[model samples]
Target: MTKPIRKAVFPVAGLGTRFLPATKAMPKEMLTVVDRPVIQHVVDEAKAAGIEHFIFVTGRNKGVIEDHFDNQYELEHTLADRGKTKELEALLRDLPGAGQTSFTRQQAPLGLGHAVWCAREIVGDEPFALLLPDMLHLGARPCLADMRAAYDRHGGNLVAVYEVPQDQTHQYGIVGIEPERDGAYPITAMIEKPKAGTAPSNLAISGRYILQPRIFDLLAQQERGTGGEIQLTDAMIQLSREQAFFATRFDGQIHDCGSKIGFLMANVAYALAREELAGPFRAELEAMLAKG
Candidate 1:
């Protein structure tokens, strides 16, 4: 019998060089979209998909991420004293319960595969979901939840993928497919950042993944691919040869918040999606655009 995927691994060890000075003192995962921090959005997505254990692969100076999930006793007490029940409730609504979250350190700037491997002890031998906080997806259903449904049906490795332009395939991990069934298809091959015009297909991997435990074994032996970093894609491709690898084309707009433009766009997109901010935010954005 296939074990249910109850745990999730979040590789958050990277230094956010792209964001520069802001990230110099703060973890990139702490950056906000709309109102909540980026990591909070990711945790909310995992929680919505019924993930029981949250394993965060952290690094030096990432203590804030840990504190974010912990109870803020002083802040909560102050809110209670001030009779700010609603604010306090909102703050506590999404924080993970004690013992539900586990933090492990990734001592070096190895790569995605290495970061994932760092959480092996916490993840144990169960299939787990992996979420990259930088890639924020906005849709009716959470991206991980959509992938979870696909995992339930297929019971193998699953990755959330979407169609990109043929020319843009080089920018992402591209997957070759067999055919489609229920918005998912059998992934024949995965090519990370394939050279221009050499890609098998334009379907690119988004940041969500539900992987089998055997992947940890493959990642253990993974070599550096593409850039000098040990890519998770390289390990996944090897796992695909021995297991059923599938990709689900999720319904959502993906915001690549790892880049400056993408981060700004995500903030705008999320703000415009909010009920309280949409009206005024849209008007101001239009006004700014009109002047530009």
Candidate 2:
């Protein structure tokens, strides 16, 4: 039987050098897509997927993320005093249940693998989900939830994948997969940022993952790869040799919020996703395009 994926590890330790001034003091994961922070969106996905514990691997200046998930007593009190019942309820609704969330510091800016490795103690020995906060998935269902379902069907390491333009495969961790079988593909190989025409397949590994605890062992011994940083893809590649690997092609729009264009696009996409804001937001976008 497949072990339940009860915990999720979120690597939010990256310095947002891409966002610069805005992220100078603030963690990029705290940046808002619509009204919710990036990390909150990812957490919401994990929560929807039945993940009971959230393990955030954080770095310096990420305290705001911790506070975001925790209650703000003064704010709640003000909302109550003002008779803003709806606002207060919404705030409380998002808070994780007691002891459901854990934070651990990743002292150095190593890489994705090291950040995930930092959460080994919290994740323990079970299958766990990993979601990158920067990759916002917009769809009828959360990306991680879909991955979780796939994990249930195929009990092994699974990575969410989506096709990129063949020419652009070099920009992502490309995966070679066997023919699709029941909405899942057996990942035959995973190559990190292959050269332009050297990619085995156009399917690129997205940020969502359902990994076995054994990955922690590989990450612990992982050496720096590609850009002098310990790449999670490197460890996953090594793990694939001994374990079955599969890919779930997420049926959704994934906005890469780590990039400026992607961040702006996510705000627009998420705003359009909201029923109350869609009509007006679409009109505003049309007007802006007309003016341009």
Candidate 3:
């Protein structure tokens, strides 16, 4: 039987240096696009994919993320007494259902692998999703939701893949693949940020992943790999050799909100997607572009 993905690990421990000054005081995951913080979008996606438990791997200054999901009884009561049910309901969506959310500290700036390893105990022995909050995926169906569907059918580890320029593949975890018809492929290998022109394929693994719990064991034995950090790709490469590893090219716009320019672009893209802000936002952006 295919194990259901009931838990999701969100690695939000990194000090987002790209948005610094602003990010200096606040956790990067708490920064908002439109009205939702980067982490909130990821949580919403996991929730939509039937994730019953939310595990946030956090660090210092990430209290706001926890606070964002906790109850504000006084505020709720005030909104209720004023007949602001719509606003109250909207606010409630951010609050994790009781017993559904948990947080743990990474306590170090290791890397993605170590960050994910921090949540191993909570994840136990079930399949789980890993979301990189810095990567925002916009779609009618959230990226995690799409991966969940793929997991339901394929029943092994799955990662979201998107085609990028060969030169740009060096910036991401490039996957070596064996075709499985249409756009799906069995990931033969995964390399972290290979030099340009040396990538096995143009397909790069984005930050979204549906992983099996056994991966924790692999991660535990993994040494400092690429980039002098415990790279998740190393553990995943080992995990792939023992079981299935697949990638699906999702139909969505993936934004690298980790970079300054990309973060600004995300704000503009999201602002343009909002009905109330679209016209004015587009006009201002167009005028700004025209001036440039």
Best by TM-score: 2
Which portions of model 1 miss their true places by more than 4 Å? none
What local lDDT score does residue 237 receive in model 1, on the 0 to 100 scale? 86
Residues 1-292 of candidate 2 have per-residue lDDT tens digits of 9999899989998899999999999999988988999988989888899999999998888899899999999999999999999999999999999999999999998889888899999988898999988898888988888888888888999999888999999899999999987768999889999988999999988899999999999998898876778889989998999999999988789999999999999999999999999999999999999999
Clashing pairs in 2: none
Give the per-residue lDDT digits (tens) of candidate 1, residues 73-172: 9999999999999999999998888799999999988889989988888888889999998999988899888888878888889999888988888898
TM-scores, one per candidate: 0.97, 0.98, 0.95
Instruction: Return the lDDT, model 1, position 256.
Output: 90
Ranking by lDDT: 2, 1, 3
Q: Between prediction 1 and prediction 2, which has the larger lDDT? A: 2
Instruction: Write candidate 3's Cα lDDT for 1-292 as tens digits.
Output: 8989889999989988878899999988888888889888888888888899999999999999888899989999999999999999999977789999999999988899999999999999999999999888887888888788878878889999888977688888899888774445788889888887889998888889999988999989999975688989889989988999889886678888898887888888888888999999889889999999
Number of clashes in every candidate structure? 0, 0, 0
- Pairwise lDDT winner, candidates 2 and 3: 2
Superior by TM-score: candidate 1 or candidate 3: 1
Candidate 1 yields a Cα-based lDDT of 0.90
